[model samples]
Target: SLVKTGTGELTLSGDNTYSGGTTISDGTLIAASVNALGSGDIDNSGVLKVGEGELKNTLFGSGSLVKTGTGVLTLSGDNTYSGGTTISDGTL
Candidate 1:
């Protein structure tokens, strides 16, 4: 199951499961860090902004994954991209 908390923070604890596609629109997800714990495939279609954390596993983005602050974007597996990525004004 998927769980969401208040606007202060959102956390998905424990081993989560998904049979179909999961979509998260305009929002912020703050865990101890951002961990994509799965051996399956992750198809990112929207804008995903990672704050301060590590992004484990493959991240397939159709849109973009913007990172602000002193955060790190970590990919443990393979990442497939169908769209383009741009870094402007020292921003990524």
Candidate 2:
């Protein structure tokens, strides 16, 4: 489930799979090419952005992949590796 409450724009292209855990609570914009094997989370009090996308064979949790306030987070793509990327907010 992908839910954006206000000021919304969302897009997902081919080979896209998200089983659970994608949320943008306030002021949301997601332009997507997401391939999920299990878990993915973007918890924002403001903004979360990933353009030019390929998040392959994914599982991300731990600190739950967070960005808070005055927020602009962008990940550009070319063989992007997170190896089951765990961002625990302890600094990955």
Candidate 3:
């Protein structure tokens, strides 16, 4: 599993294939590539920023999500995050 901590922003731009999932404990995690987040669940306790990608993972946590850029982010499955989601410039 991958745990994203601290402040600022982190961008994933490669074709990741880790199945253990991802945990965003703080700051922002940005998916710069299509399959940057891999193919697992995402437990976000911070902020998840997306530009263009398809998320088939189950997103669950107490963090917020932001969709930016000028692309489409396809989210599949039920999201149970307690925080809020804001689309400032992109399509979710």
Ranking the candidates on TM-score from highest down gives 3, 1, 2
In model 3, which range of ten residues has the least summed lDDT? 31-40
- List all candidate RMSDs to the true structure: 5.9, 12.4, 1.3
Better of 2 and 3 by TM-score: 3
Q: Give the number of the best model, judged by TM-score.
A: 3
Structure candidate 3, residue pairs in collision: none
Compute the lDDT of residue 81 as modeled in candidate 2: 29
Query: Tens digit of lDDT per residue, candidate 2, span 1-92?
Result: 56556766444434445556555555644443333212455444434434333333232322123322232333432322222322222221
Q: Write the per-residue lDDT of candidate 3 for residues 41-73, one digit (tens) a residue.
A: 889999988777777788999999888788898
Error of 1 at 76 (Å): 2.4
Best by lDDT: 3
Candidates 1 and 3 compared: the better one by lDDT is 3
Which TM-score value belongs to model 3? 0.89
What TM-score, computed on C-alpha atoms, does each candidate reach? 0.47, 0.20, 0.89
Q: lDDT tens digits, residues 1-92, model 1?
A: 23222334344444444433333332434333354332344455544444434455455757465554454545455768464543322222
Residue 5 CA displacement from its true place in model 1, Å: 16
Better of 1 and 2 by lDDT: 1
